[model samples]
Target: MESSDLRNAGLKVTLPRIKILEMLENSDARHLSAEDIYRRLIEMNEDVGLATVYRVLTQFEAAGLVRRHNFEGGHAVFELERGPHHDHMVCLDSGKVIEFVSEEIEEIQQRIAAKHGYDVEEHSLVLYVRPKNRVAGKVGKG
Candidate 1:
């Protein structure tokens, strides 16, 4: 998102907002915590505060510019709201978040919802998983 996108979202186009939005738009990691953003900003010598990071993230969530996921036993993470429908697999050991889409699962969910006489308006699926062949005392991220 750019300055114009922020203005379109009814948010003022400020330096902090622009920097944060650029981080979200360009980061390789799809999901990130406020602290993560704050650390990166600090690394880049930006003077944005942690509180400001939190506030901006909250505003972004409220404005539908991002989505927050509160995975079990972890701090909330935010992702840009610009992707296709997909489910998440959170690695239990490494806290990695993997996104996937399966037509088979979607069809089965539709069939089950239809059998129950309810249309599937929306749904979210998160599967907490660990590596099947995990090496002892090792962790991996995806």
Candidate 2:
């Protein structure tokens, strides 16, 4: 988001906020933690601090500009909320996050919720996974 977008979100257009927003929008990796953003900012010679990163991220989340996922066994990661609905698959071994959408899964979820007499308002699905050929209980790279 640009400075105007930040203004539109009701957040003041400050340097840290602008830097963090630009970083989030331009990064190759869609998901990032506060530490991740801080490290990258350091690498880019930007003066944004970790605390500022966290604060900006929190503000962005509150303003509906980003989404945070607290995956199992990991610090929270943030991704920009500018996409169609999709589910996530978090790798148990590599900690990689993959996004996918399945109509069948959606339909089943809708059917189940309907049968229970409740309409699905919102939902988040995250499947923890390992490599398909990996044996059970495998720890890490061989």
Candidate 3:
């Protein structure tokens, strides 16, 4: 999404927004919550409030700069929606997120939508899976 889009949405380009965007840009983890983002901002010595973080996230989502995903839980996660679309695989044990793209899945989705005569605007696919073995990898951001 364009930075100008934020301006057009009547949101001032504040330091917190810029910093939050930077963190999201550099992060390998595709999804993060407002609390997750606020914690990171604190680690970076940014004096941004959690409420402000939530506001900025909502603004970004409105501007189509970020997408929100809920992986079978109460807390929602945010991810920068750039490039092509993809689905997620979340490890139930560790909450690790993996991004995977599949043309077959896309085709299937399109076919289903067409069969119902519905146009898909936006969609989310999250697979919550636990490791077959108890030996799961480290917990934290992916």
Q: Give me the candidate number with maximum TM-score.
A: 2
Indicate the residue-level lDDT of 124 in model 2. 97
List model 3 lDDT by residue over 1-142, tens digit each: 4456568767788888888888888877768899999998899889999999999999889877889887785489999978688898988778898999999998899899999999788787888888886865658887
Residue 22 of model 3, lDDT score: 83
Strongest candidate by lDDT: 1
Show where candidate 3 strays beyond 4 Å.
Answer: 1-5, 8-10, 135-142
lDDT of 3 at 77: 92
Better of 2 and 3 by TM-score: 2
Model with the higher TM-score, candidate 1 or 3: 1
Provide the TM-score for each candidate, comma-separated: 0.90, 0.92, 0.82
Ranking according to TM-score, highest score first? 2, 1, 3
Model 3 CA lDDT for position 7: 85
lDDT on C-alpha atoms for all candidate structures? 0.93, 0.92, 0.85
Q: Could you give candidate 1's per-residue lDDT for residues 44-114 as a string of tens digits?
A: 99999999999999999888899999989999999999858899999999999999999999999999999
Worst 10 residues of 2 by lDDT: 133-142
- Clash numbers, per candidate: 0, 0, 0
